[model samples]
Target: MNTNTIEREIAIEAPVERVWSLITQAEHLGTWFGDAGANIDLRPGGALEVRWDGHTLIGTVDAVEPTSRFTFRWHQLDTPAGADLTEQNSTLVEFTLTSEGDTTHVRLVESGFGSLALPAEQQVAMHADHSGGWPVELGHLKDHAAVVAA
Candidate 1:
């Protein structure tokens, strides 16, 4: 496939700490990320679970650098419930925050699609789905951040 990683960035008109809370905390994350709800243990190696639509996605926290960087690894494709999520079946999702005066610049990258243990066409389709999803997701995040800041 021609794609393996999806990177998107947005400048939120909010302080770094405010942006960080929205991204790392479970409550705010559900509003912008999972629609249904989220339960994230915000620390390195902690468990991250997000429920969207009718499915629950499980992930492991890869890094949490408070107000700066947060990352996790999770299966990007639909697998049967109870499927073991490991590096062999998952992609890494990273969120980075940088302060620009009063605004926070948020960058998100989801990579490792080429390593998934799935059919080639399925891998390509998964990558394309996320590529289209990030802009809409980030736009929601930006709007949510604005409302929270107001």
Candidate 2:
């Protein structure tokens, strides 16, 4: 596993289409990703904003292949609201879904930490924080998917 990237996978007891809808739709994103809310355009190069605890993280869609892949880039460090989020200041997040029988495998990858223009310590801390966060977030997603499937 690359130190600059965080990767995680979860097997959800749901169909590919159901898992895709939970991951891509703005309303469903709020439950598993951002508790406050989310607003997404749902297309390549579309805008995505996830709100949590009064802060909104802005992102840009990179890919949207239904039930297969979804990718985006978002700022990894704290920046002023409305700041332009470019690759230089952001990290790439990718989600790939695969269907296995009755279950859907969801894989998440977040990379580009080494390129951020931040102190080395802060970069390490940020990486560690996200490393610990993905599993918890994926757990929430898995739980939600199970509930919805029930």
Among these predictions, the greatest TM-score belongs to 2
Clashing pairs in 1: none
Relative to the true structure, candidate 1 reaches a TM of 0.91
- TM-scores of all models? 0.91, 0.92
- Number of clashes in model 2? 0
Candidate 1 lDDT tens digits, 1-150: 467889899999899999999998898888888889899998888889988889777888899999999999987656777676775689999999999999999999999888887887888898999999899989989988978844
Candidate 2 lDDT over 48-90, as tens digits, reads 9988878777898899999999999997767887787775689
Evaluate candidate 2 by giving its C-alpha RMSD to the native, one decimal.
Answer: 1.6
